[model samples]
Target chain A: MAESTKKKKKGGRKKSDAEMEVKAEEASEQADVSEETTDQEAIAAESAGDETTDEGDNQVAAPKRPDPDWQKAEKPDLSLDERLQGLEEDQLRQMMKDMLLARRFEEKAAEAYALGKIGGFCHLYIGQEAVVTGAVHAQTPDDYVMTAYREHAHALQVGMEPGVVMAELFGKETGCSRGKGGSMHMFDKERNYLGGHGIVGGQVPLALGVAWAIKYRKEERVMQVYMGEAAVNQGAFHESLNMAALWGLPVVFIVENNRFGMGTAWERASSLYDISQKSKAYAMPGRVADGMDVLDMYRVTKEAVDRAREDSGPTLIEARTYRFVGHSMSDPVHGVYRTKEDVEEHKEQKDPIRLFADVLDEAGIVSQEELEEMDDEAKRISAESVEFADEAPDPEPSALYEDVYANEDVNGRLYFDGRERP
Target chain B: MAEITYREALNQALAEEMERDPDVFLMGEEVGVYNGAYKVSKGLLDRFGEMRVVDTPITELGFTGLGVGSAMVGLRPVIEFMTYNFSILAFDQVVNSAAKLLSMSGGQFPIPITFRGPTGAALQLSAQHSQALEAMYAHFPGIKVVVPGTPADAKGLLKTSIRDDDPVAFFEGEMLYNIKGEVPEDEDFTIPLGVAEVKNEGSDVSIITHGKMVHVALQAAGKLAEDEVSAEVLDLRCLRPLDTDAILATVAKTNRVVILEEGWPYGGISTTLTTLIQEEAFDHLDAPILRVTQADVPMPYAKGLEKLAKPSVERVVEQVNKVLYR
Candidate 1:
């Protein structure tokens, strides 16, 4: 492995497409073995004139041999499931339900967007639910927060009602932003969440500036700034990191590396695939956590945030995660760019929420029946949110002009009778 | 009750505002320990602590953005660039984020920020540093651009700017900051944005100007006064949301108007004001409106050439006389 790491670093002088294609072909070869076994069963069934119902389980038990070179040393199994090592069975089950609800809510948002009930650029937070819910629970309520456009889970994690979030998505007057920012711009100022910025790399420097104020005003607060891998490639990320490290600003830069950015994979997007190593350029501590694992994200972000509160400067965490859905609803979930097998493998083998439920069941905290009941409870809660948003009122026409300038319409009332607002 | 220079008025206004609001602070290169390049922030660091009075690294973009971000979270930050030429280096932050935040946030955020520094041609500090950008800055909304002429206006308007909910790009005349006038020593005093003052009233010709050029126009009016040509001088305090009523009324009464701007001749404030007066008060004008402005060429660092590049008292006098006689 040491020799291979050396060879990989030495061979890092711009890999050719042929090499990457060769790697992909080798990985698919193992999957071809499974396909071949299924094909053999199909042929046997055709010859026998009766189907082999137990063929899948038979193939799985024949030889448990996974491809050696094709296998990625299974990422220490994303400690989120491990950290629930001994959580009370009932509590663990509830958390898994929260994660399931978050994932379901995101799926519904994608459906809503397709139905034209949601508008603007909607970046789904389906696979990264555990990261938001876990980190949010560890932070103090008064702690300042800000993130880029993929922010539905952040709002939900901070305990915003699903109805208000959906109402904001629908641009209703009852929205957190008063229907001003349809989707990419919703902010709950009362929650200390600055905004859901649309510009790709704009939040880094702004969040750094907030940290400066925290240190300047001597406030016992820290900020969690979320950015995508695409933004980490931008100038603001480097620029803000330099100052944040230089000044010892109270901040935790959470880079949610969800494998693919828009359409490009992480290896295609970043020269340094391991982003934590890039943090050394600014002389700050950078850690990597499995974003799929909620407990792992919570544990690491909590340490970084606590250190920030103690005036220990900044920390960067590169949360390695994946998106279950496409970049936006417009993207094809089963397209040629990604194989269906690759997704099914993650969904079955390493889902953060599913694994947590298994831990709870194994601990006898909640049986399978009890877990199903929690899912039912969450489904009912989510079904009611759609109706609440649909019934939410639209902001008045005058609302368009009201916020342009502060109280700029002192004389505007003279143009009409004061009682005509309705 | 003491008469002070426009520069002293600005210093006093900062001292007062900082004393008044604990959240208010000033930051810029050379603003604190070095007094200021122009001494406009002199004695502030002494009056206020280092936190309230800060000296920043030579980074306009960094400090300007810091001010904007701080303002968003309920801090009042007064950022001074050495001059408007340096301030232009941070134009993207100034224009895109600070000014657009309020409107883009749908009024969720108020940028109670003030960016003040010297503007217009300073003899010998030319070309790189002596450009006027009021027209460039006034081009943006969600920001109020104030170019104060007199000491009274400098103090009052600056106080108003510090208190304004919107970001205010306040201009301190490089040449006229030292010029003296009676600034009312009142605590609760402020001149509203978008209001012009009749610095000197007359009937033959209405001469409009702002910033350092206001002094030049008043001087030109003194010369016109000797020639029995009564020139009314309008000091446009705020350029955006310009007090068109004062300009139109004065232009109609005088029937002749000459607007002087220290910027390059093309698309100067003179062009905007001349077009506005001509369109609004065209029938009342006996002679065509005229504009006296700087030479279109870049201001050379040579003292004599720098003076030649900017609109001067002689140039303002020349334009006013031409408009009045014609």
Candidate 2:
């Protein structure tokens, strides 16, 4: 917390609009807990069992492998020079602008949800924008992208129109999926954006098919798929990872460890909390990236994308990040599994947008006026999207039967209830 | 036209389609080097190379989703489950991902894929290995369900399923693979989905059936002919876009109706046909519609119990006689 305060004033910088927003959250990082503490507690819990009270005898009988040093995987102090490698000023500005747009868009969506404009489970991407924005920046326009339900940021990063995405959330005919797929499902085939899949870890296997097509068609492209850290426990995750590695498919599997999957924390849900280490069983390179640092996410993902494009194999990346908001709009941001102080600590210390903005300032890259102008542009775009969504028309009643089957013209009757065909 | 076994006909259809479209590829357990567990894909590995003919591990859910994903990007993937019973492991991908992706994505992605394999009871495959799941797939809307009973129907319908722009669940009878019939030699021959054919012309009762039961109904028709009762055997090639017009036409042709099925009677194609006939063709009926289905229970392993559990020609004959009021 002291380090963040010192770094905030390193350049003696003025408080921009975005920085003022983060100052409101007032979050801090907790003291690091060593892995040895967990092991000792587990050993103590085992000794409490009726069958084994003698700790010395149990330790001698069953020896365990030394725990991996996962702390080394984090790049908290990624140098400014490394961050600027191959990045132009314009590109850097665009990335920051895109991240701001995603934040403003989610805020507007939250407002719309409260006004009853958008319905259903409305999950917001208020935080964790760096994870998708950085990863997507490393991918080509032809490269495919897929992710779980928390994906408004992903769609925006892949160049989907903010207005169309807002229209989808409004369930308007002008939306991305013509109003069918709402918050959890966003698709733009024109952009090679597969979708915002709702099922946990369900998009992993589908990414394999995209990679397979890349190889079959002799294209130099990679399929990047993202999922929550909790999804690593699913059978689909393991099955897909095994197949992707076994076949040398061009796929990059990224797990965004936002600490919690809904109400359950990652530690309580996974026996071995190091998700990247699980890739060892599949004979693939597993790397860790600082999800809070946009450049770190970009650097790690670019390496994996290059490997996939070269047909070397697939890579597993565990991006360490956190969510400042709840799992969805209906849930409380804190108090069920996490405390208010903990959420505040993350907001103050590891806010991705603030951290990236600070980096731009430290490098003397973007001026205060430019940053303010970018923030204004983001707000304007989000406001315009809301207006467009509000004015957009709802799908016609006859539109319901459309897309049920592509060959509906040739196939038998889709409806058995004898509803008149449109 | 050339006579070929149902297994060979299926192989020919796959080869012809793969030859026609580079996007069409075959993937399954033991499909490449193993030549398929049932030998349905024999010699495809050497012919198409390893890329087009993929032999994946025994991961049904994984490979099925892979097929759906590939289809999302305009690749026509034909995923084979060694047997339809094994498809239970992949119901989530088949039912949720493949069947619902088009409608859920608002037609953004039309999954041009096919899942084909042997279905129904094969000797003493018993409870776990033997199952006719066409009704389970037909229950869904986005996917088309095809159950071809004859070798000629198998070739024509399989070619059509492979070329279909939407997801199709193609069920081939395990017991009918070796049954030889005159299959067309033309590569362009494809029977459109949701169409039915009258296997036998009769003036008395209409025996409505599909898959393996079509043969049973045909046999019962032959037996009924000796008793001066000419029964028509109608084979429903596809179940989802069901041949309702053909079904009602047969109902009008013969007032008496007998529905036959190899799977469980409750909440299946048999139940669906009974409801359809009564609802739409109720006025055409002279006698109460009788259905001959597998005894309602889990298929037992014992020979006597298995025979009793399955729909047989004798059972069909009895139902036809009752429908004929003989």
Model number with the top lDDT: 2
* CA lDDT of every candidate: 0.74, 0.85
Across residues B89-188, which tens digit of lDDT does each residue of candidate 2 receive?
9888888789878877788999999999988898887899878888888888888999999999999999999988999999999989899999999989
**Candidate 1, position A213, lDDT:** 76
Q: Go through the candidates in order and give each one's DockQ.
A: 0.17, 0.72
The parts of candidate 1 lying over 4 Å away from their true place are A1-82, A85-98, A259-273, A325-352, A355-383, A407-422, B124-128, B264-289, B293-309, B314-325
State the lDDT of candidate 2 residue by residue for A1-422, as single tens digits.
23223433532332222343341221210112222345645676568763433223222112122223232244545467756656898888888998899999999999999899999998888778889989998889989999888988898899999999999999999999899989988899999999888778788888888888888898898999999998898888998999998999999999998878899877777765667757867877677787887887887787678778875479899998878899998989885798898789778877888888998998988878789999999999999999999999999998989898998766455567666766
Model 1, A344: alpha-carbon shift in Å?
6.5
Classified by CAPRI criteria, candidate 1 counts as incorrect
Worst 10 residues of 1 chain A by lDDT: A409-418
- What CAPRI-style quality would you assign to candidate 2? medium
Best model per DockQ: 2
